[model samples]
Target chain A: MPRQIRRWGPPLLLISPSLIIIGVFVYGLIAININTSMTDIHTAAQATGRKPSEFVGLVNYTDLLASPAFQHSLRNLVLYTVVFLVGTMVMGFVWAWLLDRPARGEGIFRSVYLFPMAVSFIASGVVWRWLLNSNQGENASGLNRLFQILGVPFLQNNWWNNVNYGIAAIAIPAIWQLSGYVMALFLAGFRGIPEELREAGRIDGASEWKLYRYVLFPQLSPVALSAVVIIGHMSLKAFDLIMSISKPANYQTKVPAVDMYVFKSAFNYADAAAVGVILLVIVAILIVPYLVHTARAEKS
Target chain B: MRRMAAVAAVAAVTLGLAACSSGGDDEATSTSTGTEAGSGGDVEVFTWWAAGSEKLGLDALVGVFETQHPEYTFVNGAVAGGAGSAAKDLLQSRLQANDPPDTFQAHAGKELTDYIDAGQLEDVSALYDDYDLTDVFPPTLLDLLTVDGMIYSIPSNIHRSNMVWANPAVLTEAGLDPAATYDSIEAWFPALDAVQATGKTALSVATTWTQVNLLETILMSDLGPESYNGLWDGTTDWSSTEVTAALTDFEKLMSYTNTDRDGLDWPEATQLVIDGGAAFNVMGDWAVAAFEEQDKVAGTDYIYFPVPGSADLFGFLADSFTLPVGAPNPDGAKAWLDTVGSLEGQTAFNQAKGSIPARTDADPADFSEYQQSAIKAYAQDTIVPSLAHGAAASITVLTAISDATSKFTTGASDLATYQSELAAAAGS
Candidate 1:
């Protein structure tokens, strides 16, 4: 105990600077945002003078909850999150499994699969925006054009412009970009599983499919869970991808992050802050429980 | 590969910094970057036209303005955005921070209300008399800029919003005459059908603000000038069948638009019309400059007419400048304003801007055939303010209306619901 006490001071000193920085930049800003949201400040109020906003308790939150725009955005965020997470996970696992085998050019295929990860989401978004454009016939030069060349007119849907599948369409580019990273995660997890486990399954007369279904998949759940956490938070705070890919005021693709931006520009400071807080609460709902379970699992 | 991702991350930070660099919340207006405002050494003229002919137009004006005042430096601090959204945001932040530029561009009417109510703009009513601008500018245009018996901004130029640019050859191919004009909104249906039969998208529009342009034109055609003007204040009832009819026509208009429009901007939409991929585009007269820049001759490569049934009305919006309150150099700002609202400034700026000079006295020969027609139309037709471009309504109201229009254009909302939502927006 005495030795542990003596060792603590240097470690404490080592972490203090980052702690202070995070405290000021992240937590301090968050608190200020929350305080700002609990008021009646708006564009008109702010323009007259940046006054100390009169406290209005939960009025901003109440108004946001009642607003159709906010409700629509929340719905989009949920839909976008589900499709992105599942799409990335499935694509990642498939890519990992294909490349995990002993094959000639495995290194080349692996590099090719990982290339999209190198490009930023915004960069991918701009390119995909054109490729997925809903223009028809000669004007269409992207995915729709390929469909035309393939003689499969049925495959030529309005990609992202179709609002019913708009959120899902956004997920396609996202999955394309992040699935390679997810594959890296799964590949690591696959490598971490000792040969003995597979050998035991093989000794039991289990085929590769059976081994994958029962043994391999169950063991990768932890890695999958971690990937979900990473991707989940990303989808919650999604701004740049949507901004680059879609129209700014496109209600079909609007999410809370975009709502925050639109509101901020209009000088509806209180509403903007409310959107920020709602985003925080959602991220917390998704991540806090996963973090707690992971901590407990590590301890156990 | 890692370097590329790092660059993307940096790009995101650069955008954030640009937003914050609206001069921050320090409340310090003075900077050493330009010549001191108090010294009469520099008069920073702010605008959103940092590139293309818009910039060229501003440079032309600056060239003229500089010749008039050799003692002062004219800093062209133009931030660029598709519309004025980016510049507006930057200007808003700077104004809030109390670091007003000596002069800034704004839409003349309701758009300047935020700055005025916030006490960011100085009343330049006296400059109107001193410069004899009351004689040069039309009373209708002057009336739009006046708020509570005081004029807040000096309009440099006027651009009619309800202009329809067409590819003459494409229309001729469709068996429609190159110079044809529809007498009503419903008349466009047969025309668009003919264009579509020729295997072209009948109409072209861009993503956000362009939808606003289309919506405003549709409203004016259906509602006429007096009722259309009533749509802004509490004078017209949005729940009336007239608005419902306008929304219906708006929906019909969207049916003819290019499906890939959400991926394009206004210029691209104009190019679509020019390239014969689309037959028609409802845009501001600025599309003339864009077409001219591409070496497309007017009346042959392309033709423009006011949107069907709206020829009797000049749906106008003005790009004007304001002498911001607490300007570092009031004399320099007054000089700039005098130049902006003056005959020489308006003529030079408008000739390059593809807009008609706000002053009626500008010689028509100095403008293009298209712009001369616009000037003649401005003189003969009844003037109505534009809702889409922030002339008829406040930004808050305009934003709400835009949201409804955007949603409706995307087929996210039906006509009746959009009508009610618009009513709620205007009433708010």
Candidate 2:
């Protein structure tokens, strides 16, 4: 009994602080939010009182389902997540691939690409909004001006206003800001690939593409999965970019986070909590499967 | 590694300790007032007007308070955002923890109704009687501050949110007179289009709150002053031809606007007009302060106009000041409120802030020419309550309007859809 106690005591002691903090801040808030979602809290006034809010279980979820904006937000969110994932992954891989070759100033280019991550998300949103200003018309300054000079039709298209392109335009900043981190992950994964595997692939007359596909791609799944999870969560909570890119006049570009902001503005704390819960559910759905798969692979 | 874990643990411990220490300091600092009851004393006022000319207006009021009562220290706990929304949130949290500041900023009307309902506000009726603030402030403005005959908040500035500031240079450059009537402003729109032809911003209106501001002025201008109230508080149907016509006209007017208005703050939008980068700005009287900061005179460098047909215009009066409620120093908060509504406070505040004094009896000689016009209009009872975005209830309702209006401007929704959405939102 003494030996068993000794074995477990130090381990529990080491993790106790993290456990307490998470239990209070994370798990506690989650419980409160769940309670709020079950009741009718119209404003901050109604939210805190002795008269407990009537619990109409699942009614909030039903109301959310009935909301047009919520439906639109959900659809846009799916499109945003998928596109953001594919775009960041492809761009990060390509950039990483280019830098993987023995090249001059590789380190400088790598740092330059990653420098955006160093800036806060809000700052990135501001700078990009300035760059994308289309009010300058034909003499177009910044990105628009450069696009016009290069005879690129994308600038004249007003992609930010185009509903089909609005989400994509907002996603561009996220891609720029996050692709660097992805590239770093992929670079590490590439380095981790056993060199002898590539040599053996070549010995078997495998082309460079075959060598990457057979030798490197499988090995990079763990890194790629991590990148996807990180960027995926970031895109899900993407607020400042959507806010900066689209004004109140352009409500079709509204996302769940922006909608949540609106809810808070209206003092609909309960509904905001409901929306938050919905967002958490969606994120869990997206990530849990990947996490399970990763866990299984690790166990093997 | 164990070393990495140890380093992270140390960092976490340091952060937790720092946070705990700072929070303790904040609590201690807030409740340190030990003045005897009824004796004039120091009050730490928490507000969010710590920048630009706003700071100047605040300093003027503080200066007056110090002159009147030398015992008060006037702890300027001014935070960083305009309107103290950030500070208000912090104040609410502190109040919940039973450690509120002596005074804190609150909106004039139903915005503070929550605090009053919670039994967290003080009745300043006696102060109102003693200071004779009743004679100075209009009954309507007074009515908003009073709830069940109890005044909770004080008026700092009676800001008019429906003024259109135009650049005379840009107007002249476009072959349009700066003093063009709202009807003539339409004539200038094409001329303003010509200003954009010179590769400058024609109109500086942005897409968010500014769009809503422009929408309110346009609605009032098109529907007339009474119709503006009717659209929100009145029994009129928003689906009527008048509302549709206004929306269509506004969509057309938006074409003359800055392309990057979506991302611009109100000050930056005002800057477009100040720099002659834009022809006109449909903004508020607080914008007058921005122009003053730039050393631009009202009638010469820039122009102010009531959107045509909105002569008896609708103006949103959103003033801010701290209310005494479980306050650290109720006496100090009362002193602050008394000075806020005093004639001297009104004059200095109005001059520096570019807003009219809420007081009816305050001398208009202290006001700018534009404020004088607004004051005369108010005397005739021509001004109505502003029901644009902020003046209305519920952030939910406001956001719905913001979203609907955005859709209306972007051509994503027609007038019918917009009205239906607004009605649904309001009903909700």
Candidate 3:
């Protein structure tokens, strides 16, 4: 027992502080949130008082699933996730490819591309709101004005005001903000590949496109996957950007996160918690496989 | 020996973290308890008047508060957001945590019903008697303030929501009378058509809430004051033919508004009237300040009237303060409420806020030309709560109504669907 303690005690002691903090703040709060989601606590009055709320077990979930607004938000999430993931990865890869070889002013170009990532979504959202202002004709402004100046008035369509796919328009800003970070990831992935792999591809009489397709792109899948996961979860949890660009009541860009905020503001805590749990499950559905794959890779 | 030393080091670090966290807990507890023990300490008055003329009004009120209650320090806990949405969210969390401010801003009428039902506010009916407010404030105003014979808040200022602001230039360019008053919404449609004929937006509107604001006025105009009030108290049926007519009228009015109605805010829409891009805007009395900001003269540069068909009715929403149930300093809060209801405080606050004093007895000479008219109107007009500004319904119901209105205005839902959604919201 003494020998075992000597081997394990130091590491366990070292990790205990983080374990306790995470256990209480993270896992414990999630448990509380799940408990609250099952209860019929809708008002601040019910939430604060000594009397416990009645457990209505999954009623809140059933109600949320039935709600048109919640369903609309889910649809928005799927659309946003797809657009944001694809846009970011493609843009990131293009920039990474452009800078793969050493060139003059390459660092400057990279910094210019990456600088948007440093700005908070709220700050950038305010600017993008003006840039994407949907007013046309005499009231035209922002990018619409630019289109008019360029004599391409046809391009001055409502950006995020298109009812059917406005959430997809919102993904434009999300893509602009994160593609730079993805570019960095892809660049690092490129740097990590051995030079001999490219030489071997070239020696095999492969064209440039074939060399990239066979040798480079396959090796970069891990980086692309990482970018997708990161951007995927972000799109799932998007709030402030959408809020700053539009409003909570704005149906065109409303998401589940915004709905959660609205529900909480109305003191409908159970509904808010249900929305929160749904979002958590959605994110888990996305992340769990990646985590499992990483774990297995590490084990092998 | 070294391994044992490493284990002790790790244990010490873990103990330090635990100690740090516990220390934070102790500090938080001590501070909270200290605030709870407050007698004549800080009087934190929470509000959303963190910028613009609203902040100026708050400052003016704080000045009155300091003069009357020098024993207490006024803590400005104003959170900035358009329409107090952000502030209300923060206030809810604080209320849930049992850490309410000494006093907080709330709308008078049905908005207070939720807080009253939750037992989150204390009845300040005695304060009204002590201050002789019953004699000072109009009976109509007092009726709106009271719930089940108890008043929970003191009205600071009243904003008239059923006002139409028109640019004389735009009206003249459209060959319509700017100062002309329409007896009903039907009488007003031709004027909107005339402006539209001149290739201008007949009506300027902004966002979902503004549309809801317009809808409320139309409802008031069509149903009359009693039925309008009944809409909140469960007396009037939302599915009735009268309501359907009102919703139809609302849709007709929406057709005359700007194409980008959902993209702009109240100020921007009002600016359309100010700049003569649109002939008229239906906005609250706060637009008076917006016009004044642009150096526009009332009655010449701009013309004002009660919204068509809402002539004898005041579509009203008042900003009021409350004595929260677990307030740290109840006496201090009472002092604040006293000042809020006091003539000097109301005058100072209203003059700066571009709103009329809620009190009936305020001197007319102290106000502007438009406010003088509003003050007279308030005494004579039947005051009905403004739905868009949190006076007609609970927040949840109001949110539901707004959501339904948003869908209808966006063309996503039809009038029948809109009315049913509204009925469902009110029923819920």
Candidate with maximal TM-score:
3
In model 2, which runs have C-alpha deviations exceeding 4 angstroms? Answer: A1-3, A50-52, A244-252, B1-41, B82-85, B88-99, B114-120, B182-202, B231-234, B322-324, B392-396
lDDT of 3 by residue, B290-368 (tens): 9998888887899999999999999999999999987878888888888999999999999888899988889999999
Off by over 4 Å in 3: A50-52, B1-39
Between 2 and 3, whose DockQ is larger?
3
The TM-score values for the models, in the order shown, are 0.91, 0.88, 0.94
Interface RMSD per candidate: 7.7, 6.2, 4.5
Residue pair clashes in candidate 3: none
Docking class of 2: acceptable
Give model 3 RMSD, 1 decimal.
Answer: 3.8
**Chain B alone, TM-score of each model?**
0.91, 0.83, 0.92
What range of 10 consecutive residues in model 3 chain A has the weakest lDDT sum?
Answer: A43-52
Q: Model 1 fnat? A: 0.51
Q: After superposition, how far is residue B386 of candidate 3 from its true place, in Å?
A: 0.8
lDDT of 2 by residue, B285-388 (tens): 77887887778887899888766556665475666565555576777777887788788887887787677777777788777887898777767645555544
- TM-score winner between candidates 1 and 3: 3
lDDT of 2 at B393: 41
Order of all candidates by TM-score, from best down to worst?
A: 3, 1, 2
Residue B175 CA error for candidate 3 (Å)?
1.3
**Please, what are the lDDT tens digits per residue for candidate 1 over residues B1-428?**
95685446545554555456555643345443233455456788889989888888898899788877777778888998647778888988887667788899998899887777777888889999999989888888888888999999888889899999999888888999887778999988998999988889899999878898898998999999888888876798999988888888888889888888887889989999888889999999888888988899988898888999998999989888889876777778888887887778888888887888988899999988998899899988999998878899988788788788778877888888899999998986
